[model samples]
Target: MKKIFVVALGIMLCTGISNLQAQNDNSETPNFSKLDASPMDLALYRNQENEPMARIIYSRPQKREREVFGKLVPYGEVWRTGANEATELTLYEDMKVAGETVPKGTYTLYTIPEEKEWTVILNKKTHTWGAYEYASEEDFVRINVPVRKAPNNIEALSMAFEQVEDGANLLIGWDDRYIKVPFKESM
Candidate 1:
């Protein structure tokens, strides 16, 4: 009886240790910098009652001679948009931008940069490296937005949330160019 009890106790201890180890290994990497950057709020169906969601914001580097489109960024590639993971666009609620409605879900954000304009894509996949293996089939929505020259050069790809009368402006800027797309909550 004594031996059986001791063995059971040992087994329990081993199981507990294994569980703890697994948890440690599976823990997600901390995103401390995200807290400091301004966030782009997304509220879907404002008339309805639902919890608002938020995402940490980041932009690609806008270094000169870095090669963008057919070079650094590559014409057709799956760009992650940042250093760690793909560019992350947090959705607070289901919202509409550029005349398209996007559901309340985190998406791997990408853009096909061109001289005249850009085709921004919001894909269902989140974690990826550069846009090397981009698949259009994975895209949830694609919007064509015009780009404008910035008075001042932007050293990094930048995104900001600006308040408007009815909604907010999701702005993306890089180098000497900037683009703003309006995002409004759908009723």
Candidate 2:
């Protein structure tokens, strides 16, 4: 009886120690950075049925009381569209942009800001860090859209879809200016 009890006690003690050792190894804290200055955001365009038609993933940079266009973001230069990384646009279906039909796929969104208008570009390259390596040959579509003044100052770079009769307008606002890029449903 004593021998049996002693063996059982040894087995339980060994099992408990191993379990504790495994727990300690797995409980080590992971090294992570603090929050990003320019946080990431998502904008989705949905149909009347609440089905998502398209989505945009980008980062928002604050104006911070600085001149945005023609100064901080120079004119006639291909901007990543926002800070951090190049903007990512995913199309769920075939759509018309600037009178040209674009197929469904993911693409990097770039832009050239001007005083009167802005040229929006959809490039085949995705997961790009910035426009430093922007290739004009890889552009899938490019459209020139007129810029408009926002009613109020937009502290942060913002993007949203405004649903219209035929489709939706991608509204981008920053500082005191805004622009609309129309996306019409294809037949």
Candidate 3:
């Protein structure tokens, strides 16, 4: 009986050791991904009731000592509004943009940048990568906002929501220029 118990114990220990070695094997280790050059960020705005009113998800790219507006981004051309993927905006409820009532939904935000102003567009399309396949006809609403000089040079692209008496404004700034797109609650 003692000899049988010893043999069984030896077999169990061997199996456990083999399982542990297999788990620690580095031969098939996964190739870990590195950090993104332009990290994605989110900005949210909540109403007085503490309910989320709007949210934006976008990648913020650094200026990196390059001319952002005209050279790096180019002028009078559609830009993804950030880096990897096109910026996405979600409205929890129906909101008015540029005096036009936009239904509550998720949309891609694209921009036609220019020297004086930017043509901000909200499209019905989502999950788009950059503005390579952007279609003008898919646009739900288009608003042209004049560009304003930033107080100082912005190293990275940034966005935020500022509450106002009527609604709120999405402030976007990068390099030395910035713009404001307003969103008002639909009545």
lDDT of each: 0.66, 0.93, 0.93
lDDT of 2 by residue, 4-121 (tens): 9999999999999988877667457455679888899999999888878889999999999998999999999999999999999999989899889999999999999999999999
The whole-model C-alpha lDDT of candidate 3 against the native structure comes to: 0.93
Residue-by-residue lDDT tens digits, candidate 1, 1-187: 9999999999999999988877667365343454423232322222223344335445355466565545766544445554444676767677787778888788877877776777788888766665655678989888877878889977666776666655676677766777766667755
Q: What TM-score would every model get versus the actual structure?
A: 0.63, 0.84, 0.84
CA displacement after TM-score superposition, residue 67 of candidate 3 (Å): 0.9
Stretches of candidate 2 off by over 4 Å are 1-28
The full ranking of all candidates by lDDT, starting with the best, is 2, 3, 1
Q: Which window of 10 residues has the lowest lDDT sum in candidate 3?
A: 23-32
Answer with 1 or 3, whichever has the higher lDDT. Answer: 3
**30 Cα displacement, candidate 3 (Å):** 5.6
What lDDT score is found at residue 101 in candidate 1? 85
Clashing pairs in 2: none
lDDT, residue 90, model 1: 69
